[model samples]
Target: GAGVSQSPSNKVTEKGKDVELRCDPISGHTALYWYRQRLGQGLEFLIYFQGNSAPDKSGLPSDRFSAERTGESVSTLTIQRTQQEDSAVYLCASSPHGSLTDTQYFGPGTRLTVL
Candidate 1:
């Protein structure tokens, strides 16, 4: 009955470097999400994955940001050519199902710092 979890709780990287953040959602959950929170800003939706359906990636900021998930398990968010503007808290969440009204359980987030 573990909650969602993210790895490397803190990441420090230089500009132009690439970083991969990992997430493990609750067992049996069929929906997973990735979000970003910038300084003094609200959470920004990055991507969403549900069951075997195609992922919703409309929220991704640019081509430099990408994510992947296999089945209903672990997910990874890769940021290529990191930028200073990319410094923020990357959050992961999961719900029982991919529904708009479902409650999402959040992880502690991986703080990414770009220098």
Candidate 2:
């Protein structure tokens, strides 16, 4: 495939609401990662999934944040009881081997706004 793709490019919701962000990685890529970027801040690793191995959930901020990837395809990030501070750009990236040394392709990101 050309590159990673994300859905619902932008979202607006009240505080305490839940939001689901979707990402489609490039075909054949085996590594998928989710990150969050708050305004004026850097990207924070959220979650990572590679192959059939168990996902690395250490990066998740809290129990409210979770993600799931099916094989090497699409992945979803779900935020429960969203807070205003959760407003930011959620980014997804994919690599061929899910290795730190591999080059990763990034998606456009989903801008989330919690009013």
Model 2 ranges off by over 4 Å: none
Question: What TM-score would candidate 1 get against the native?
Answer: 0.97
lDDT of 2 by residue, 1-115 (tens): 4889998899999999999999999999999999999999999998999999999999898899989888789999999999998999999999999776999899999999999
**Local distance difference test, per candidate?**
0.97, 0.93
The residue-by-residue lDDT of candidate 1 on 7-115, one tens digit each, is 9899999999999999999999999999999999999999999999999999999999999998899999999999999999999999999787899999999999999
Question: After TM-score superposition, what is the CA distance of residue 22 in candidate 2 from its true location, in Å?
Answer: 0.2
Give lDDT: candidate 2, residue 62.
Answer: 88
Worst 10 residues of 1 by lDDT: 95-104
RMSD of each: 0.7, 0.9
Error of 2 at 3 (Å): 0.8
In angstroms, the error of model 1 at 48 is: 0.4
TM-score of each: 0.97, 0.96
Candidate 1 Cα errors over 4 Å, as ranges:
none
- Candidate 1's error at 112, in angstroms? 0.1
Which candidate number maximizes lDDT?
1
